[model samples]
Target: MSKQVVFTIKLEPELRDTFMAEAAADDQPAAQVMRELMRGYIEQRRQAREYDAYLRRKVEVARADKTAGRGFSNEDIEAEFSAARDELGQVV
Candidate 1:
């Protein structure tokens, strides 16, 4: 393992007791469970950042398209939806 860093976490008595009981039931220390949870949390955060960047790029590309300036009127949007629904046999 890498160098160790000690840190303190303050938990209410009731929560602390519950955590210890669950940890013992699983036959693993709470610290190990916390590490696993931290790993998953970090992964999700990284994914969210990547998706945000992708969405920003997609929006920039969409704005540069001439068709986007046509900015569908309500009637245009409804007509397109009606055509799609008719093709798909959907209840419009």
Candidate 2:
């Protein structure tokens, strides 16, 4: 395991009491609970950033496709789906 550093923060008494109580109820230490919460929050933010980048790339590609006349219209999509439905003996 890597060497750990000490960190400290202040919290309101009420909030601290509630957090401690909840941690005790789960049979875990408050520090462990805080660590898990921090890890989860960091992961969620990381995923959100990755998703944003993916969306930006998709939008850029879509814009490039539109400029190159490679984009399809809604009517084209509907027509393609209609044709597929007919071939598969399904109702539109």
Candidate 3:
């Protein structure tokens, strides 16, 4: 088991009632619902940041490839794939 910390947040009465009702409809305690929501929010934000970093790395690689004159044109890619398909006796 991990150590847990006590945290609290203030919500408007109406909003809190609504949240509790939704949690009850789902057969979950309101605290559990809030925990799940918090975890999902954190996961989504983390994934967004990771995706942004991945895009940055991909752009850097593309720029380096361009600088080194190592990239292919659309025609070049199509031709290469066509040749590979022919070699493998596969239909396009």
Which candidate tops TM-score?
2
Q: Estimate, for each residue in 1-92, the C-alpha lDDT of model 3 and write its tens digit.
A: 35398777898999999999999999999878878888999999999999999999999999999899999989999999999989888653
Clash number by candidate, in order: 0, 0, 0
The true-versus-predicted C-alpha distance at residue 17 of model 2, in Å, is 1.3
Error of 3 at 70 (Å): 2.5
Q: Report every candidate's CA lDDT.
A: 0.85, 0.92, 0.90
lDDT of 1: 0.85
Full ranking by TM-score: 2, 1, 3
Work out how many backbone clashes candidate 3 has: 0
lDDT, candidate 1, at 65: 62
**Taking the tens digit of each residue's C-alpha lDDT, what string does model 2 give over 1-92?**
36398778888999999999999999999888888898999999999999999999999999999999999999999999998989888642
Error of 3 at 9 (Å): 1.1
Using lDDT as the measure, what is the rank order of every candidate, best first? 2, 3, 1
Tens-digit lDDT string for candidate 1 (1-92): 56389757898999989988998899999888788888999999999999999999988877766366845677888999999989889653
Those runs of model 1 whose alpha carbons end farther than 4 Å from true positions after fitting are 66-92
Worst 10 residues of 3 by lDDT: 1-10
Candidate 1: residue 38 lDDT (0-100): 81
Off by over 4 Å in 2: 1-12, 90-92
Clashing pairs in 3: none
